[model samples]
Target: MPGCFINYRTGDGEHVATLIDRELKQRFGSGEVFRASRSIDAGQDYVRALDAAVRRCEVLVAIIGPAWLDSPHRSGGDGRALDDPDDWTRREIATALSLGTPVIPILFDGAARLRPADLPEDMRGLARCQNRRLHHRSAESDLADIIEAVEVAAPRLGDMGEDESSEGDSGQSSGGGVANTMRDVSGGTVAQSREFHGVNGISGRTGDMVFGNSGPVNTGTGPQYNGSTVHNGTGDQIGVQRVHGSRNGGESR
Candidate 1:
């Protein structure tokens, strides 16, 4: 039986989810966790299947991103309607809470801090239950949190073969401290647009990147970039990649 149900968005945190699944499998034997990527039956009721999996699990590990807060199940700001009646994320959270399952909220890429005021009230409650600030740190820090949360909620989860210490004893040992892993705005490396959660692109030999745009600008020679604007030697616009704003088409060498 699966001991933990890991919830996550397939778009941004897929890699993280896979990593967690791998770790869980290593820590606990195989088939201890259910991940969507491992499709069991063809044409199965995926939502129902996932819900059932959650029901059987002792822990619901919510691998959250910014998208989780704005889910359709929760009311948007000012009682705005959600787009769906049975949002998977909302149902997953509700099921976990209803079943008294420990919903350990895991922050992916510091998404908890990015929550907007427009988020729904119920979603806010979920956020309050397991704050990113309390546990939202780097992947390494989160691993420690995961170990702690599971130990607290499901003491018999992983193998205690060589390790005689009980999870309950070890879980409470780790301090409830939050670690700061945010990149330095002043000196840290800026993640390229293509490398962001929402954007995708390919890099060229000159370190320029190109993405979704099929316009002539993307076809231009010299270094091609996927940012908002490309700069030449004189700091003039050579091409524009408007992700969410105006574009200026100019040529510079």
Candidate 2:
């Protein structure tokens, strides 16, 4: 069962739903996050699967994009798809709300906050839910905020690593510890240490090693061979001896 269910319209917030699913899956395990396109298996009843997921999930994220409120219904004869009861997006959110599941409204791609007048009677309560904003330029930070909110809403979903958990708890800006390091440096030079060791040789005809800005560049010492070798390392040469053996004990020459 999923702890988080992503509810989104096909044409309005599908991309944002995918992004949220991926990020949540990474923080929580993949099994803990649900999205229709990826979570529903082939030949399965999609309606049943969606309803079950919504009922079981601890949180339902409703990704509302610019077109979400005014998108046309699939039936091609509607004022807006959200007003239609058969619409999956509307149904999923309605189910979550009815089941007392925490519903999170995510505003994306210049979407404005929801207004009660814009939604049907059943969905008007969604306008009262606090909303989060996500923009292309600040996606990382926005995602961090959403994750923190989810963690708070569902403490049972608290399996993130220590570093990430701390980041979420502190309400720190994105980039994790790297952002903290940059913030702490006032005027003096800040440096980070890193050492790369290879058990075997690191050699190639044409290869490049890249490092981030925080650390000094240092490549390990090793011997270079024209062709790929079993091991490439700096060491004393040991004597090589040849042994004569016979296959199946047939003969030796």
Candidate 3:
């Protein structure tokens, strides 16, 4: 069973959730962390799979972006998506809470601390849970801290992490499967996170392609440009000019 379950709205903190899943798996083995979209395969009963994962997990990491609670109340209801009985995000969190599973609420994308009054009756207890903040600028450190919290909540991970130090493999999983992609991406400046091993530089044209990161950038009203020019170092570079491999994780919708 996956010791950790990552929960987030598709369009909200999904990217952060993906990042968390990737990092956690690396530190604690691939089977220890589960993200529904990536963990559930085609034709599977996703409803049952989601519930099983939540119930089996020792910890649930709730990725709450700014829109998590601010979303429009469904069907003219009082609260937001939580008011909807069918909302998977709400259901997952509620199920975990109901089972008394330790939940780690991660605030990202400028999300504020969840307030008890903002939560519906079934989830008000969520507001009382101690939380952590994840920011883009402090991603590495924040993730390190979050991992520490996970280790505490899911004591099972303590033994797994001891022998799974991926210290040398982190960030090198670049340009893996489906390394580069561009689809339905219109105009504007496209930016993505990339890692080059001993490479001096890289550049691409308007119609060129590069891969990795949350998703393609959508720059409405502006032209999209993904080309880049940078100097890695002043020395004679001895680097792999090209990187190609299967992507290690799932892409955003």
Candidate 4:
């Protein structure tokens, strides 16, 4: 069963839905999140699939964009999609609302807060529920809040997410922990990090470096090779060199 069910209209907020799905899956692991586009298998009855997912999910995330309520119906002319009971988005949300499932409204693209007066009678409750917003400028922080909220609603997701985060935890046996492998670092100076998981080992000659323990930094005169490893994840190796009293350039030779 999916821990979270993502309900989104195809044209309105599907992109954000996909982004949320990817992030949740990355943090929680596979099969824990249900997004119709990615979770529904070919040759399966999508209606039943949707019903089952909604029923099993701990919470339903409704992605509401600006066009959500006014989007044209899929079947024919210019009728509003939300006005149609058979609409996929409408059906999914209505079912979740009727079933008393936890529904989280995530409005993006400057969407206005839902108005109960504008909603279908059965789904009017959705308007009264507190909502969250997602903006491109603050997507990262917004998603963090969203994940935290979902984790609260579904304890199973919390376990899955934490396990994934601590997969390669690094650092000393005591104190803050590190990861086994760090994500690619673009550009910056890192000195004396206490709890950073190091993976793959330093390719070149490593000076004053410890994989899991704290190490020293280069405090030499003129220019010194601090031996700070930059893992870009590409096959090619890029060296980082520190030159004192001059412009910062060139990797250590």
Which residue runs does candidate 1 get wrong by more than 4 Å?
71-83, 113-125, 131-138, 158-253
Residue 170's C-alpha lDDT in candidate 4?
Answer: 36
The TM-score between candidate 3 and the true structure equals 0.63
Query: 2 or 4: which has the higher lDDT?
Result: 4
The TM-scores of all predictions, comma-separated, are 0.51, 0.66, 0.63, 0.67
Q: Show model 3 residue runs off by greater than 4 Å.
A: 73-79, 165-253
Q: For model 2, what is the error of residue 110's alpha carbon versus the real structure, in angstroms, after optimal superposition?
A: 1.3
Sorted on TM-score, best first, the list reads 4, 2, 3, 1
Error of 1 at 194 (Å): 48
The models' CA-based lDDT, in order, is 0.54, 0.71, 0.72, 0.72
TM-score of 4: 0.67
When 1 and 3 are scored with TM-score, the better candidate is: 3
Candidate 3, residue 245: how far the Cα is off, in Å: 37
Q: Write the per-residue lDDT of candidate 2 for residues 1-253, one digit (tens) a residue.
A: 9999998988888888999999998888789999999999999999899888898999889999988999997879858888788888888888888888888999998998999998988888899888889999999999999998887777787545355668755544243322212232233343322222341332222122332324322222333122222232466453323211211111111
- Residue-level lDDT of model 3, residues 115-168, one tens digit each, is 899887778878999999899899999999999899888888975564344322
In model 4, where do residues sit more than 4 Å from their true spots?
162-253
